[model samples]
Target: MSKRKPQPPPKTFSVRPKRSLRHTLPFGLLLILILAAFSFTSYESYASLYDADYVGVEVCADCHTIMYDRWKDSPHANMTHQPSPETVVGDFNDSSWMLPPEGQLLPYDDELPAMRTFTEGADFYMALRRPGTADFTSFKIAYVIGYQYRQTYLTLEEGGSLAPPPPAMVYRTARVLPLLEPPREQHPHSRRFVGANDHPQFGVEPVLCPVPHHQLRHSGP
Candidate 1:
């Protein structure tokens, strides 16, 4: 007996069948979960409403008592208030000044004639004669705060309507401002009669309206 050939171990069929649903289900579910997560994050990132309705500053004041109190006392809070007698500095009396002589006609060929001499003792005066006629005049007064070399004055005319000055006699200047300056460019100085012909048309033009209380909206960085 050829050392009884060791009976070869019965061929044990151990081939592992390919895992179908078991392997694919988890991978498919994981891919789907990842896709959903990415979609949710993307939607949150880009979707936002800009320029939404605001609650207003008064509402904010309710929570910030101290800050609101300080803001209330600031000049911004009193910007549009009526000027009381105590706060007003100009002479309220009906002071008048003449722009040109009674019969003198301004030369239309040249620029409108400016006031040669204003009436003495008048609290208010006219800087330039009216457009066509010297007899028809407007009132002007020097500004208390002069910047840009241009005096800001209250014009008698408002958008082509003739409105008289307030009884308080609050007025501004009508001086042309400089547009360009030496080395550092400066605005033109205020002039009585600024026109298109003027170098920069500073005061004559309507571009330089001053905004005093614009900073009120800015709280901080």
Candidate 2:
């Protein structure tokens, strides 16, 4: 009979919980990638700033062929060089002349002091007298500056090698030479005399490119 209808078997059901790892795993991976990229960039910047050296014009030419070509023709590139036949434009034909002391022309009425500039083979020399005395000191031409318009000669500064310039530079010297011209020699029309600037400090002087004074034009002969 309809005895208590057998209690319907209780329905069985299970509820599944949502996973947190799915969302968190992707977020953690993204954070890790960003950190790795930042660390790599920082290392590169540090290495470049502190570990670079002056590699000279040849190294520059490798990457900047066009720029190097233009600079090669400019006066700055030829401003200074080791003594050589082609680099030297001045006459070094074993000639010597007496220069008026300080600021005067030749043929002085009094026994004014005079300095001598002479050449031995290819080397140039300047003989200077100490002030208030007849002591003379001669300096040899160690380097030359200016070849196109005007030129100045430099002698190796005493104790120059003891203190080298910063590693970034290719060359450095504490000495400077004023423009000197022998009286008998026909100097370049464009050349002018400059005061001797002897720096007491040992270092490299700042160098700047000279502005071209005149341009050259070529024509058929």
Give the poorly placed runs of model 1, Cα more than 4 Å off: 1-48, 77-221
Residue range 123-199, candidate 1, lDDT tens digits: 44444344465453445543222222222333323333222122212223322221223432222222122121222
Q: Assess candidate 1 and give its lDDT.
A: 0.38
Q: What is the TM-score of each candidate against the true structure?
A: 0.28, 0.42
Index of the highest-lDDT prediction: 2
TM-score of 2: 0.42
Residue 25's C-alpha lDDT in candidate 1? 100
Model 2, 18-70: lDDT tens per residue?
76898789989999999999988776564465346434566678889998788
| Lowest lDDT 10-residue stretch of candidate 2 | 162-171
Backbone N/Cα/C clashes per model: 19, 0
